[model samples]
Target: MPHVFEVGELTRAIKAVVESEFPFVWVRGQVVNLSRPGSGHLYFSLRDAEASLAVVWFRGAQGGRISAGGERYDPLTGEVYDRPLAESITDGMEIMVAGRLTVYAQRGVYQLVAEVVQEVGAGRLWLEFEALKKDLAAKGYFDAARKRPLPSHPVRVAVITAPAGAAVRDFIRLGRERGHGAAVRVYPTLVQGEAAPAGIVRAMLRAVADDWAEVLVLIRGGGSLEDLWAFNTLDVARAIFAAPVPVVTGVGHEVDMTIADMVADVRAATPSHAAQLLWPERGMLAQRVDDAELALRRIIGTLLASRERELAVLARGLAWLSPARRLDRLAESFDGVDKRLVRAGTGYLDGLSRRLADLEARVSRRFDARSLDAREDALTRRVERLTAAARMFVADRQQRLELAGAHLAGLDPAGPLTRGYSLTTVARTGKFLRRETDVRPGDKLEIMVYEGRVRAVVTDGGPDAGDKS
Candidate 1:
């Protein structure tokens, strides 16, 4: 008889075997029901193109501090996606995951315990679309500021679309019909499928990354909204947003709408319309070029005329600055001032000096000649009168002297003697007297008491007479 094992024992044995066999492994798949409970445990169904398995990640599985949110990626299609996501977890735009693949023991299923998730979903993409639209609109990126003036002679272009799609034919037709080379570069990519988002995003990044393409013409012939959903992804939107060059999106038919059209720098209703935005018709461009040439000629002519006018004005200025004219003006001014100064200084000094000299001469004439002559004449007459007076006085003195002499002669003693007045002689005494005493014997006397004096003896003249001598 075969021994039967209990269900719990069987499950435990299976768990032991499964863990022992698959302890360290990695599995990639998509989640069907991704959920988180309040107990901090994660539960989900991880599947692939073949089959799906139930999964449970217990709270104990996380070492500590486990978070609930990650991005919810699109279901895997057995193709490896190598593109790196932009943002990490806790960014609100949750991603499904990428991490260690583990199996649950109690549930008896294989599952994916993801480390990360990325690439936003439909609802996430829609939210991003609304948010970006509002943001760019507020910033006026959708306004006139970000819009560049389209080139009229856009000859070479890089076309971004499915290679075999109808959009290529439309671009080719439009480029040729405009009589322009539109040199289209067809970069083959998936417009719709698992790889379509990355493909479109890559094409967009390249349209700007490559230096040849001036303005990008993102064309798709026409499509329904679902057919163009790859273009609506946030990945595509981000790629278009980051394009350095200007982007031109012509995604769906005129009636349909896609997020690519919204995020693009410029949007056209159709692929044919993108051509119009990029290049005008060749005929219009040629006409414009011709017009520009003519304008340049007219500007040259106007500049020449203005230069000629300025030259004439400069010549007139030069003529007005002649050296002879300037010298004459300065000379005239100097002459006027010099003459005035000379008249004021010399004329005043000369007139005053002349008047002063005349007054001085008149003053000199009033006293010098007449006064000097009259004083000389008066001094001479006075000197002559004084001399005459002195001479008269001398004459008077001489007359008086003569008269006095006559009187003296009249009184002379000799005359008296001659007139026989009285002559006495003393005998032997030589005495003369008016009355002579008698002379003594032996006395001799002779007397004459006048000019003719007689020698007389002194003996008789004293007492008795000198008669006794």
Candidate 2:
């Protein structure tokens, strides 16, 4: 027979399958039948032309959607945002949502637990960015093997950014605090607007021609996809790729990925991070130095202690090698041998005395007549005890035999007749008559006494047969 599942069991199984299969998804549809309950949760259905799906957005679960790049960003501009878009969902609004699929066990229905919702519009810039990224990737511009390693500690670092921008200022400040005394020289360029692509390329060419810096750092702050399009252009990507020295990019926010970032040797989340990547932190370096000094001191102490132990051992050897020490050691050895000889002689004499005493005891035991007489008396007493035990055992057995024979005589059936009690039975059937109802009047019956049984006919057989007699 097929197994039957309880209602709760079936619901839980469905919940697990639905949740695991569609843990996260993006769905676009028109919202309908929206509800705002007092529990601070939004319940609704999203439907396309063909089908509808239920969606729930709990207040506590409401949050921004993270992109495939491992961070959240605006759906249109591609700039990172923190506020949730679920609050803007209304009745009959067409939107795109990202969430997970799960079953509501109480209602026995599956719904999307929406986290992020976006009103669909103006995504051309994002599309163009994706197309260029794909093209550059196909050209092997984003290969890991093609990327160059940055110097361990660059003495001079070049920044290709607007001289007055916060990105440059943040970079320089972080460099001063964390760097190993590396000089930062800014190469001025436009970071946004139509002229930004060409201006960035020019700054790169200038830095490459100068060739004074060990590494090139390109940086900018966060912006919409349109504002950051210059970094996504092929011109800037090619310039970073063709640079003589290694190029590091920190454009836009951590979530933003531009063509230049994909092509550069290293990518940092922000301007501060780029500087951090370029040089080791000053405090960290100091800590490392302190740790090394401590370890070195420990090593030196261990070496000195080992040498002192060796010196002590050598001093003991020298003391033992002296003539006086050797004479004292020989004198102690001679005293030990003399004491052992004395102990051996005393032990031998004690063993001989013990043997002589043992022989004298054996001779006295062999000649003792009283012990033999006492043993004979003990044997006679033991024989008397055995004979007494046998007599008592036979007497007990005879008494038990007599009692058993008396019990058998009492169980005999003839004993009751001998006591004047008679037994009667039907003569023809040989059945004992327990009551008068066993026979009718004139039926033949037998009366049994101690000696013999006598046959007779029943004259009256009724309920009052005994009273009539």
Candidate 3:
């Protein structure tokens, strides 16, 4: 009997067998058809002259776990190597890849899942560079917010570079021409080889500590990647990040970007560009100063004109308020008032003279010397008669007043009291007591006599109780 298998069943059986037979392997070839989709998964074909194999590297698989040279490692921790294999890989690069063979069940195709990768020639150095870059980026050293703006016209620029190199010379010459003769302080440092990173870091620290310049420029001429590897070191990147003042980096050619450039406050394409960015040309600055002076003169002239207008207004007001003018007006008013007063006085004196003459004429006609003598004699007779009548009236009134006084004296009640008679009154209310029934036996009494008043308590008061009243 012949048996037929289903398509899905057949594919699954083949996938199981191929994956089990080649679970892990190492393949060496030139990379081609490298494509990274938006999902961050790398797909490529490792091809030789005769054949090719499909391979894939997921984004998460980059620093997950890898094995190289018969040893296992965690690329994230830098346990065994400086960097993971993924970072050093590129298209057309001859590489040795370590991975597991896996089969896609849907397509029924077998592919290599890459775990580790390494470049053929410059594998180690590129790996270290990648590692340091990743580390510093994770620590926020390459944050855009931390970058500082460059000075527009720096008066003093401190340069950290090799003194003997063409980079320093170019920088100094350009700064002199464009920077308006800015002072350049060169902190000579080794820009290549083993001792370069430490030397650059120390120079940067010293430049900052000494307050050397307003802006610091770290420059080096264009070189191969190996020649410029010192600027790509972790120490140099950190030094640039930690500088107190703004740091400008110009390392290698325009195409090359080192870690120092990424961490610096500002990145320049070349040493000459760094100088141009730091300062303005002398001729341009002189033009700007001249423009500013013209603007200042215009402003001053406007202000002076406004002040002069204000002073003229004040002078007009002061002229109106002058004391001499006020005194002149007052003198004019006084002259008018003095004329009116003189006219009034003259009119009044003439009226008085006319009235005096009329009164004198009336007196002269009405009264003669004989008539005045007759009036005097009549007045003397009347005065003698009035004197006699007043004497008679005064004597009569005096006699009548004496008689009335004698009558009032005889009728006085106090006069009776002085002649051995006494008057009694109830002491509580001051009522006169005329009879025995006027008071009670225990009542207090006041007796009025000639010399003094006597206060006594009544022992007996009713007629039936005592015979004497």
Arrange candidates by TM-score, descending: 3, 2, 1
When summed lDDT is taken over every stretch of 10 residues in candidate 1, the lowest stretch is 71-80
Model 1 RMSD, rounded to 1 decimal: 49.0
Q: Can you tell me which runs of candidate 2 are displaced by over 4 Å?
A: 1-25, 29-33, 44-54, 58-61, 65-79, 89-94, 99-115, 121-135, 178-181, 192-198, 223-235, 253-259, 282-469
Whole-model Cα lDDT per candidate? 0.62, 0.81, 0.78
2 against 3, candidate with superior lDDT: 2
- TM-score for every candidate vs. truth? 0.37, 0.47, 0.49
Q: Write the per-residue lDDT of candidate 3 for residues 383-432, one digit (tens) a residue.
A: 56755654555556556545755665555567687779998889766889
Candidate 1's C-alpha runs over 4 A off are 1-156, 176-182, 313-469
As a whole number from 0 to 100, the lDDT of residue 83 in candidate 2 is 53
TM-score of 3: 0.49
Clash numbers, per candidate: 29, 0, 0
TM-score of candidate 1 relative to the true fold: 0.37
lDDT of 1 by residue, 35-94 (tens): 677887666665677986555555554332211222222232111122323212222233
Off by over 4 Å in 3: 1-127, 331-469
Error of 2 at 272 (Å): 1.2
Between candidates 2 and 3, the one scoring higher on TM-score is: 3
Give the candidate order by descending lDDT.
2, 3, 1
